[model samples]
Target: MTVAEIFPWQQVLWQQIRQPENLKRHHALLLKGRKGIGKLGFAFGLTQSVLCGQVDAAGVACGKCQDCYWFEQGLHPNFRLLEPEALSAPGGAAGKENEEGRVEAAGTKSGKKPSQQITIAQIRSLDDFIYLSAHQARDKVVLIHPAEAMNTAAANALLKKLEEPPEGVLFILVAHGASLIPATVLSRCRQIAMPAPEHKLARDWLVRQGITDPDFRLAISGFSPLLALQHDEQQSAPHADFIQSLCVPEKFDPIGLAEKLHKQDLSSVTSWLQKWCYDLMSSRISGRVRYHLQQADSIKRQAALMNPVAVGFMWRNLAASQQLARHPLNSRLFLEELFLTYGELIRPVGSETR
Candidate 1:
């Protein structure tokens, strides 16, 4: 995968992090924003700038410099990237765990899928790296992506380090939500809000990538074009029938729909239903649909029949269903129960009791 140094949208935040006055006072940067918006990529860019001894006028790393070469090679001694063991890739961080003085996680060899967590052990491992003298004479940089993966114990352990970060240490936390970190930790860091790119900018970027349905993908992924590619926005033959069936909620056959949907994965089943419910809710108030841009008129027609209060309850039910979506229960029965409940909330006008 080709990694971008930074996206066009990140220019302003890039400047903020590079500003000497701002960079000097802050030991930690909280890169908070929506998922898949390139926060971690931005963190990598910032690391290059801070560690590069010969930065130019714009504060960007000069690609020809020694520091830049070392960083690009992922051999920069002062740089450390902390993420879940499962999420961590070889050479993405400084080096192998033992070689770079990182904690050797015993859990990786368990033969199960590696953890999706940055366990307390990972956080505590920083004790040696952060406090150690910089190997290359530049400041030490620790990049943490998807910071929300840290559990309660890990978050608490990190609070102390953030509060009194070691001199010459830069802690960059890339996360979707700021509140996911403890209040004490948050207060100690400088937060940089990364907003989704403007429509035209995101569209232009996606066009360069040769995406066919740029606008539709952008709409469905909540305006984060980068995230758009991760979802299958195209309605294929199998999903097409299921999607169309959602427009007329009142006509749903719980058993038939459940049987059809359970054949698909539980996550996809719930996500599509949740998106449908969200469109209903959005059309109820705004007369516009987000994900179902092509079916806007149909969505509005359905919205006209349903009361917002009724749709609100449907949304809550959908949320509950999503939370339980991971359970390996009888998928068909689970979906049948959900569809039955959905049918009630979205019953036709005349079907409502007097």
Candidate 2:
């Protein structure tokens, strides 16, 4: 891995952040935003530029100098990347352009699932890296991706470092859920709420990546171009089937649908329903559907007959379901109940014939 390229949508913020004054003022930066919009890539690019022996007037790494060469080869003595073991595995999301960089493959325990949380041991082990003399007497950087993955012990350990700043060191923490981070930790870093590109910009980027019907892909993936690409490449068929089941709520089999989709990522499954329900509600109120662009006519017809109060309540209830989706004891049972509730909301008593 070479340096991560900053996306077109990120140009303005990139320039703003790359300013010498901004870099000098903040020793640590918390880059927080929705996932799949290149927050990791931005962090990676910033790391490279900071360590570059020859940075351009634009503050981008020249990629031709010794420091840049070592960084690309993952041998930069002054730089370290901290990420979960799962993400460092071969063929993991870390390998993708949308979410790049894994300094080295993490050692996995045989027959055991790789740990997801950043361990206290990992944070503690950073003392030498932080306090030691730099390889070239330059600034050292430590990047923690998905910083929300830090467990309580790990976070507390990191807080110690943040509380007493280390000279000549920079910390870049990338996170999708900033709320999960402890308040004290949050307060210590310069928090940057990363931007998502506008619909047109996102759709154009997806189209350039060879995604057909970019509007629907963009909408379904919450307007994130990288996510839209992932969805199109990985989940198009399953997502279409899921949407089809939702389109005909009266005839759909919640049990069967749940069985089919239970093996999938529950969080993603919940989001699909959330977006679909949102479209149903939006279509009824504003005569428009947001996520399911190709299914607008069906949504309009269904929304017209549905009880608005019931739909609203169900939509609100999905928020709680989303939380449970993360740690459901029984995936199939959880999804079955979810679909059954949606069924009731869409075709409540005396509303089917309306």
Candidate 3:
């Protein structure tokens, strides 16, 4: 993808990448942002640009160059993409162990055994790759997507290499949240913060990608185009329905809602909750709520009834829940607790019953 097509924030980042002076001292670079903002794509593109045999005026890699061709074909010896073995698991972090306290490898789509994390063993393997003379005698690029996925030991192992990287070697670390990374890791690298896209721009991009529903765009993604594409209308319908049910002044069923959500994957539940909070936040600000358009009147009424401070408080709780769900948490209990919190938030103040 062209730099302009990547994301607005990425285009700004490309300016820094294009200047050789900017690359002088920084060997390890960390690009961090929210998911679906194209951090990984930007990392890959940056790597290819650095290794490309031919570059255009914009300093973008010429697609037909040998290096670019090999990269596209996944045959570039000088380029490496490192991630946790379970590619689909969020942020590539290890999942919880089973009843016996034995950690299972994360599941892979190819049915290959899951790897616990990007282990020190994997980091050591890179030494063999990098220690060799540069493939093209130009630059050797290693793109470590979701660098935070490295376990503590693995991160420390990688840190040693980062401290004294081989000549002509470049390491790009991509993470959604840099807080997960250790302070040592943060200090060693030059950080590139990829901000979220503009809401209207992202919406237009999503519409071009065939997401036509305005409500869908607003609900699923506040300002990230990549996230907008990941949400499916079919899956979002139930979430909207659940919110509608809660908007009414009636007994809400937290257990039933949690069960329904448990049927879906953890990522979907997190996304739904994130979107729901955004919708509520938007409703509070705009005095218009369209996430559940059919229940707009009810939502408006509920929004009016709730205290703004409490709503803000609930938003923070939901964010915490999202992070907690990432690692080993009782999914059922987590959902139950979240919904119960929501129930309490929407309940009439000083009510004896919720």
Candidate 4:
């Protein structure tokens, strides 16, 4: 999407970035925001617009221009997108149009896993790309998404470039967590804080995307409209079942629930469970739930009967579990343990049975 076609919430920010005169003042730009807020997308849009041979008054690329065509086809010589090998795959968001160097299709070494980090090799290759003048005589643009994915070596290599950036070169780093970036690297860039839109604006945007109960989806996504739409389409059913199980103590079926969720994505399940537990604490003390607004009433009712201290303890456990969620030896067993713990916490006020 072009800057002109960006989300309503992003228009103001885009305008600040779209001005070529304004862009020349900074060599490195950090687009930092929470997940699902389209930080990477905004960075890409601005990159395209800036590199376009022709642009509208809003600094939107004209699809008819040569540079714009090269960008859309992922063949722009002066443009480089550095991301995990997976995201740069032919079908990946980084460059779905690129048929070469697709990580999944490229395969990995024996007993070695495909790396998700931006490697030093990838960073070093830019030495050639950046040293040369722009093919379009505009600017050499390097986009690194989720810059936190870079390990120490890769970050150090990138830091060198940031420290001595070539003229007419722009480095755009899209990070969801700014703290993950090296202090040396972060100090050299211009930080742009991307805030989430207001509740009504987020909900209305979700509605425009064809989501029913926009507020519910918005709440589930932490008010990120893009994530709300994505979750509603991809994960609504499983998420609903999981949330419902936690909200109603009587409906708690630990074994069956564990088996049901065991086959799902363990990481996502872990996040959902953590959010559910967090809401329990929120409901107990604050009479509100942040992530699951739809379940606030039920959460509050259950929270009233539960011990707040116990709820707080469970929340911490869930948070720790999230750290190692992807490395579970057995998903079903892990879920069983989690559900069992939750079952004990929510056991009826007087009964001993789970």
| Residue 330 in candidate 1, Cα distance off native in Å | 3.1
Cand. 4 TM to true fold: 0.89
- Please identify model 2 stretches exceeding 4 Å from their true place: 1-3, 95-107, 232-234, 259-267, 284-288, 307-313, 316-334, 351-354
- What's the number of clashes in each of the models? 0, 0, 0, 0
Decide which is better by lDDT, 3 or 4: 4
Error of 1 at 338 (Å): 2.7
Cα-based TM-score, every candidate: 0.85, 0.86, 0.78, 0.89
Query: What is the per-residue lDDT of model 2 for residues 1-354, given as tens digits with 9 covering 90 to 100?
Result: 424778889999999999999998898999999877888788889999999989999999998999988888988989988877666665444534232122223455574556677889989989999998888889899999779889999999999999998988999999888999999999999999999898888888878877778887777766777767766346667888999887776678889999999988777788788888888899999998778888999999888888887888888988888778867999999999998887777765665633
Q: Is candidate 1 or candidate 3 better by TM-score?
A: 1
What alpha-carbon RMSD in Å does predicted model 1 have with respect to the real structure?
Answer: 5.6
Model 3 agreement with the true structure over 131-247: per-residue lDDT tens digits: 889876888888775687789999999989988878888898988768999999889999988867666767776777777774455544544566557555567677666665576
Flag the better candidate by TM-score, 1 or 4: 4
Point out the worst 10-residue segment of candidate 1 by lDDT: 94-103
Which residue pairs come into collision in candidate 2? none
In terms of TM-score, which candidate is strongest? 4
Summed over model 3, clashes come to: 0
lDDT for position 67 in model 3: 82
lDDT of each: 0.74, 0.83, 0.70, 0.78
